[model samples]
Target: MEVRRRDPCQSVQNFSSSSAPYHTIFVFLIPLLVGVIEINNVQNRSKSLIETHLMSMCLFLLAILIYAFAYFAAMKSELQVFKAIEMISGSLCSVSLVSIILPRPYGHFSFIIWAFVLLLVAYKESFHMKIWQFWNRFGGNNQQLLPTKCVVGCPAYP
Candidate 1:
């Protein structure tokens, strides 16, 4: 059966109202907070090593955050988490690529790694997803590989 799509606004409203995976949220956000805080020190006598480390950590944290949000949002909402992962992966890949292409930086590898993680998240979500073919376009019947064929050959072939 074809599922009706819910309004985006309503979906977000419902997600926020429900309880999500708190531990998952905390794990990523805390690192992000710390990394952003560390970046603040760059204002005075900024060193390349410090900048590079902070940038890499922040990029990793942001990637983790994206995956966490999708994973948790799925816990409360009826929305397909795979779709969210796919969208996020595509976005992350683009961002990572742009960062690598323009203005060479020491943290180029870090951005690329984020893109890789996004891909892994997408793959994991897809593999775990139980696609209800019966409730989907499959009409709840056994999926046919090719149109029905005779054991040997069809009458028309003979």
Candidate 2:
């Protein structure tokens, strides 16, 4: 029989309920709240049950994928995950902005989108300090994550 050795750099470890970070509550609450709101909006605004169900399923899948990615990244303690999360959050913000700015009759979806986008932004920004520290500690200061020469003097979001 072979005994497995644990990696010293492993970031995730099993912990008792009491030992877990309280901040993880946001992980559960944000998804649950957004799901309920998305379902309610789809039900109220969609023209038919089929459309509502379809949209809800799509939203559910997207939300699940996003949450899964975030959870895994957090567990694995990967700093690169933030870039993907930021891209998705920015896209969601753009969608919400469009929904708010456009003169359309998408009242229900508008609020739902806005809420989800805000939640995502808040969640990501909550770790801004940690992310910055990680980058600096890992020798990422001199390396550029994105090309910025296209726009002179302007800071790139990526």
Predicted structure with the largest TM-score when compared to the true one:
2
Which residues of candidate 2, in runs, are more than 4 Å off?
7-9, 12-26, 30-53, 82-127, 130-158
lDDT of 1 at 11: 51
Candidate 2 lDDT by residue in tens digits, 1-158: 99976532232232111112222343444555555555656746736433534443454457456655654555555454543563454344334333433345773476577677657756887675564566556644432553424344455421
Q: How well is each residue in 1-158 modelled by candidate 1, as lDDT tens digits?
A: 99976544455444433322333334445555455544654575556433645554454447556755765665566675543663463345344433433355633765666668667855775642333322234432222432344343544333
Candidate No. with top lDDT? 1
Error of 2 at 51 (Å): 4.1
Instruction: Provide TM-scores for the models.
Output: 0.31, 0.36
Displacement of the residue 46 alpha carbon in candidate 1, Å: 9.4
lDDT of 1: 0.48
At residue 84, what lDDT does model 1 achieve?
Answer: 61
